[model samples]
Target: MAIWYTADTHFGHENIIPFSGRPFRSASHMDSALIENMWKVVKPEDTLWIVGDFAFGPAAKDMNWLEMIFGQLPGAEKHLVVGNHDGELSQLLPWDSVSQLTEVEDNGKCNVLCHYPMITWSGARKGALQIFGHVHNNWFGSRNAVNAGVDVWDYMPVTLADIERRARKLPINKHWTDVEQRTAAE
Candidate 1:
């Protein structure tokens, strides 16, 4: 099965938060749109790596909602790399949750998975690449990193090409510009 990665779904984030400008008139509408888009690209045998922010609140309150939406997606299995936004996922959801940064060694290359970006100097010691989410933008260093954020569109899953282009440019000295943050929020 092919493995796909994505992050920052923000399912219940309907109204635009002050920090993130995601807009939705209602929670149900946002959830429906997100689910519909996710299923369009995902196949029954495909595996999805949801990096983080699976749900908005307490597990009990959000479990039913998440189950309903996730159940409709066509995927053989789903792996989660927990993010700051996800709360009590193990207690709320049946799926396994990983608390630490995950690493994969493939074809003489190493892949590191985490919710946050590492310091610029950290990339110098890496192997193949490091893929993560959380910063939205303003990634550091030139080792290899990907942003699986909400801005990624449906049907078009994040591709290796996209990741490569962004990853090649690293050691960003400045913080994520306000414009970039606004774009992500939108």
Candidate 2:
């Protein structure tokens, strides 16, 4: 099955519209768009990984609302990386897996998933790519680490290939040299 990654949906948070300069008229409008966009790319046989901030606001506290959102997710298996906004109830949504930080192997590479972007992650020197959210649209992210947040993307889940392509175009992290030891291959 194909794997997809996304984060910072902020599904029920109304303030996100203005805060993130989202074009949605309302929370309902934003939510619908998010779901529709996800369905367009994610499929029943694929895996969906929400790196962080699945939902927020009062609606997120409602189990029925959360269940409805969870039920509508398009994927045979779903995983959560657990953001700051993900409460205990959000964590109880029957995800295939949930963690504060975890490593996933995709396309013969290890992807380090977390809610907050890190200056460095496990296997940073070994070529592991770090995927994260939480910062919203503040930055586009560095080469080895990328933001999978919906705010960075066009409000949809993205595949590893999409991430890799973007990573290639983006500049290397300024801290790259500071964290990763250089080899004298040059």
Write the residue-wise lDDT of candidate 2 on 1-186 in tens digits: 899999999988999999999989999899999999999999899999999999999999998899999888899999999999998888999999999999999999988999998989988877788999999999879988999999989898999999999999989998877867677983
Superposed by TM-score, candidate 2 places the C-alpha of residue 66 at a distance from the truth, in angstroms, of: 0.5
Off by over 4 Å in 1: 15-18, 58-60, 90-92, 105-108, 120-127, 137-143, 152-156, 169-186
Separate clash counts for every candidate:
2, 0
The superposed Cα distance between candidate 1 and the true structure at residue 76, in angstroms, equals: 0.9
- TM-scores for every candidate against the unseen true structure: 0.71, 0.95
Per-residue lDDT value at 119 in model 1: 41
lDDT of 2 at 132: 96
Candidate 1 local Cα displacement, residue 140, angstroms: 9.3
Q: What is the C-alpha lDDT of each candidate?
A: 0.58, 0.92
CA shift at 178, candidate 2, in angstroms? 1.9
